[model samples]
Target: MESGGWTIKKRSNSSNDSLSREYVAETGCLSIVVLGASGDLAKKKTFPALFNLYRQRFLNPDEGHIFGYARTKISDDELRNRIRGNLVPGKGASGEQLEEVSKFLQLIRYVSGSYDSEEGFRLLDKEISKHEFSKNTKEGSSRRLFYLALPPSVYPSVCKMIRNCCMNKSDLGGWTRIVVEKPFGKDLDSSEQLSAQIGELFDEQQIYRIDHYLGKELVQNLLVLRFANRFFLPLWNRDNIDNVQIVFREDFGTEGRGGYFDEYGIIRDIIQNHLLQILCLIAMEKPISLTPEHIRDEKVKVLQSVLPIKDEEVFLGQYDGYTDDPTVPDNSNTPTFATMILRIHNERWEGVPFILKAGKALNSRKAEIRIQFKTVPGDIFKCQKQGRNEIVIRLQPSEAIYMKVTVKQPGLEMSTIQSELDLSYQQRYQGVTIPEAYERLILDTIRGDQQHFVRRDELKAAWEIFTPLLHRIDNGEVKPIPYRPGSRGPEEADQLLERAGYVLTHGYSWVPPTL
Candidate 1:
């Protein structure tokens, strides 16, 4: 049956063959359950993505349903209003866009209840079943997707509730899947425990641990950029590359969110998940195939090669006035920024430094993977530094790929200057709206694609690489340096790079093009 722009294809009731990763999401009777539907993540990201999918005709509200589950006793109108406030359609939203939103909200129903109780889940199941029954699916056609937007502290209880009361009893007809949001537990032990809890309810195939960075357009393109293009294959190694830096900087601080911000420092919040995922794409060996397992296996190998960061290799800092927020402890030592060097033990990246840097309230708001290549060995242009080539992959503000190349200055003097071969997504794909990170990932979750999601072992491997450093910070073995709230993160970050023989961006400031 055709629903809006997308045709909802039904799976056969007696098909013995398993669905391909891409085929897992192609169902007409889809009911998406958003666990923390009233929280900030649900309102700000979950709903907006669903609304966009509906507006773009990728989701048909008439055929699909969205269940908003939360403890708040909000009316349907209140929930819609909250979602509307967070959604800011690109400049051209008009009559069609406004109409689409109104229609999309009709498909969303809010269920107010506790995350741990059976009664609430039963109510949720009834709401879901009512929608499913209305479709009168023959069998093996209706599918359910659960998204956990709540805190990790409640993951186990939520999973238990779903298994005990809400899960589809048989994959004989339609399947059931769950999408998990991160910091995927604090460290190794917590992550394992959470995994165990979810494991008890759902098999690995039923779980998708999502990381938003993997959904970014530029990040998703890393594989093609490296493998498809011959230009990079030869030089993509420690031999030709000087150092690699994956950076995430935010110009704004926690902004009174100390309650949430103080719980996990910048390391767990950004570097360990987002920044590290980018590194996997940038450094992992090419997989034999593009299958989900194949791709995930490569990421695991990359993580496995990483050596634990030493105390001296890490730099931590807390932004000033962090304690001024009442939610934060007066003497809290939680870090707002961290810069750590990861050395891959494998031969290809043996001596190469994968510098993962992230911070809140810094010089700019951007996430990028900068690949700095070794300087040309011999250059007749004995000018200042005989410039090194750098590939900059911007992941936010605007998505883009640009490379620094040395060229002769326009003047009569035989001078060299750096210029870019640009491919800014906005200019390159004019009028094309690149979906938000959450939107793409949500669609993937529905589709049952695990290519971009984090696997259980991958999580443990990443935690292993950073657990020691985290212990140091938590145990007071190291104190985070204090930096002014609005400045670039601690000055030591600069010294670390310089000490590692990194030549900073000299003349050009890597700025995202105005979208």
Candidate 2:
């Protein structure tokens, strides 16, 4: 129950070749069933990630098996071919590893069944039994993991089937975990209802709510940067900080997935899941232990403590002609751009505004967090007031960390200028392929490291913070401001920060370059 540090249990029979390999092997032989496995998510991310894990020998000798369930019927050979096509064995993967991966992919079994049908589930059970018998993995009951990679609408029914056929009938001693992806629900009420339904079949501890952003090395390093170093611990609060900015922007429009984009838009897609998760990491109080519960508890507190945003402080917008996309329905009010300022009502962050902005179809592409610090109150830098000191964590394109501080110019005029102590990943680390977010997450799930996984209460609190705004949007009380296709969102977004007494670090530029 202690949550201060990581709790790793040793598996008696399983071991890896090396410490690094051990990290993978300790997960034990896993029987993974990816529902909707033939879908885009499965092809693009899931299979490729699993292959990476396999290449690392994270699996056992009788180490692995993946089941793909969908309405379409496909042979194992075809599934292997499909998986191989998506994999990029560019680096960190050898020809032998690719051959092994292909061999492992042959272990993938596909099931064709409707989600709501009893016969479908009965058939699914048959497939599981077939894999178990084929692999002769009956020495000890292997772990069974169900990854619901389908849309949220189908989630409840799929979960119900799993409960009726899979969880109820399957052997209980071995670990059974279910992974649910986002957006977990449309709003707070839906989120709570979904949580209750999931809790019915799976305990909170057994459910692994996946938020891919948390799996990134840079994101996880945030904890190390704050807790591991003495330099940052003292200055990480309102006393020395000015404000925080979290931005996730995209240059391309909906890309013809407009129907799907219109339903949730930027708020639910990015701000609710990605941006808020990042904010919690930046704002949370240190947990007493590293248990999923403790870390999530701290994260939930940060989310719950985020004071409600006033109408004037929150801004929403839709890109021009967004509703005109063929896939979008008529009169769609979904916003493609959202910017809101939150005031955390906690001792460490009281009165400090955490500005969150996320939008699609912006100028440039970026996902970054900027932490700004207040200037030395009324002292030395009055004559050279440039801007607040900042630490920017760039999450994509070129992953890097930069700190802005005042440094003296080479010439001896006693004049000081601000410069960045930059740590660029692309520059500093050479010839190393930064593993994809999916790669890390899939591996973490196998390792049972819940530090990067979202907890139940954290999900609830996140929805609570944005519930009011969501309600307003549903009721048509807030109309989205329109911005150009190739710009940095609406003018109101600029005004939102300007009114907060903060300025954009790079003026009002496009979020990313247009494709």
- How do all models score by TM-score? 0.94, 0.89
Which lDDT tens digits does candidate 1 get at residues 222-324? Answer: 9989988887898999899989999999998888788888888899899999888888988999999888899999999999999878777889999888888
RMSD of each: 4.0, 5.2
User: Best candidate per lDDT, number?
Assistant: 1
Best by TM-score: 1
CA RMSD (A), model 1: 4.0
The worst-scoring run of ten residues by lDDT in candidate 2 lies at 1-10
- Model 2 deviation from the true structure expressed as Cα RMSD, one decimal place: 5.2
Give lDDT: candidate 2, residue 485. Answer: 87
In model 2, the Cα lDDT at residue 47 comes to: 80
